[model samples]
Target: MPQDRIKTIGRSRIQYGPLSDRVYLMQLAAGEAEAVITAMAELAQAEGYTKLFAKIPGKNAAVFEDAGFEIEAQIPDFYADGDKALFVSRFICKNRRRSCDAERIQKVLEAALKRAGAGIRHPLPSDWDLTFMTADRAEQMAALYSRVFDSYPFPIFDADYIRHSMDENFRYFGILQNATLIALASAERIESGVEMTDFATAPKHRRASLAAHLLAAMEADARQNGVKTAFTIARAVSYGINIMFARAGYTFGGTLVNNTNISGRVQSMNIWYKPLAPCPSNG
Candidate 1:
């Protein structure tokens, strides 16, 4: 992979950085706790990684915690049903630690929530349009992403990487002005829960509530498509997006400590969620 290191080990999909000290664990199924933990720690030491991060069902938190992983955050009822999700991290490389501005973020989040704008704004004029994107528009999407974010959590700003994710169950939506793509978001559905993320807006149009309009459109479409929930892991330090979610009526789920590498640094993230099923029609 031209991006991060991806490996499949015993029902787990692990993504790690060759030049970084962090690891992301996905699809972490049950069983083989000792083997996975031991092997991962040894590999982290050998490959110079400091921490391994995993977001899993809350029920599994205890098992991983017993294996040296510590709970960083929890989102209540995050699963499609009523199960919760917990973010955990294990330090394998000695003397290497990562800490976010948790105290500051708490204050910022609280203050931002007080000023949240609406989630769904009125539709734009005819000159502005919104459409669900495909792999062919990856270059445009990547360009906008690179412009908006100096560093992204994943290798999404790469066109080929976008196509790769498309093949692995990812979808994109774009906002266009005068037929030019301006803002974008994605909904990566896992079962009945959709991760409403990867949001970016062009610099000139940042104040126009394009994200809010786009989110409303996405949710309306998702409702028709059988989506049961929408959720996000928003950057904790960013007031704009955080407030946007709050305005949209998403419940605040807690903060993930130093969770993702974004905008050139490892930053903490906040979880926001809303149930999407069995609802009224969109305006």
Candidate 2:
């Protein structure tokens, strides 16, 4: 098990969980943010981290901006109660930004959706099964993840991590083939929004549309739970998963440049999101 690297500076909770290279500002203290950010930077450098990122409230944005953090993406009224959130990042490694136009992401999502209208009406496999995972299934889930992924943002490969997360506002779903689990995904409640994350499938099960099926169930659960925004910070170079989000109706938000260290190296991630409730901008 990884050590608890969450630093409590004033009232803020800065975390360095399983994904070690990136320190997460899990809860930015509402007051004394400037001081907290300063402390965060110092600690991040001391830890030899490459990045410091946060999903922060819009009200405290200036503090992060003043600390040399850039806004990677934003969602209006993201917090189910009408608050906005910003995905901000500070690079302790090399100061870099990838070129990712909002319009370009829209174009890509549109093209992907055009190519696959079937995702809109996606249905589960006839013989396969979808069920919410329980704590007893943690070891089973971890073993399945090992077959598909080398690394993940969180510590899903560890049954203890899975069990702890499942207790902390995370809902997991799995697809069973002949009563054996072959695919898995999770929706983690963050503030008022939900991140459709931790998606994995065995190599033998690829191209079988299991992900889309599980995702459909995940989103429906989100809507029922009153989640307003759904998003994913997916691997940028992953054509199939990226397309899957677009096909499921998530629009492109922006790119997080070399932000995540996954599968043994630092990888750029694409932001894809969708609104479950109608937007005021649309009305």
RMSD of each: 3.0, 4.5
Which digits, one per residue and each the tens of the lDDT, describe model 2 over residues 1-283?
A: 3433656778777777445476778777567778777776777778677788887888888878988899988777777457787889988767435434445544655566565434644456688888999999899999998788766666678899899999888999999988788999999998778999889888888778788888888888888887888988887767678888877778777777777657665677788788886323434
For model 1, the stretches where C-alpha displacement exceeds 4 angstroms are 18-20, 91-100, 115-118, 121-123, 279-283
Candidate 2 TM-score versus the reference: 0.86
Angstrom error at residue 45, model 2: 2.2
Q: Candidate 2, clashing residue pairs?
A: none
Against the hidden reference, what TM-scores do the models get?
0.88, 0.86
lDDT of every predicted structure (CA atoms): 0.77, 0.78
Q: Write the per-residue lDDT of candidate 1 for residues 1-283, one digit (tens) a residue.
A: 2346778788767787753457777666667555666667777778787788877887777778898898776666667667877778886654444454767788779966786554455456677888989888899988999899877767877889888888887778898887789999988876567788899999999888888877887887778877777888898988778888888878777776666777777678888888786557678
Q: Residue 273, candidate 2: how far off, in angstroms? A: 1.2
Query: Best-fitting candidate, measured by lDDT?
Result: 2
After superposition, which runs of candidate 2 have C-alpha atoms over 4 Å from their true positions?
Answer: 1-4, 17-20, 95-122, 278-283
lDDT of 1: 0.77
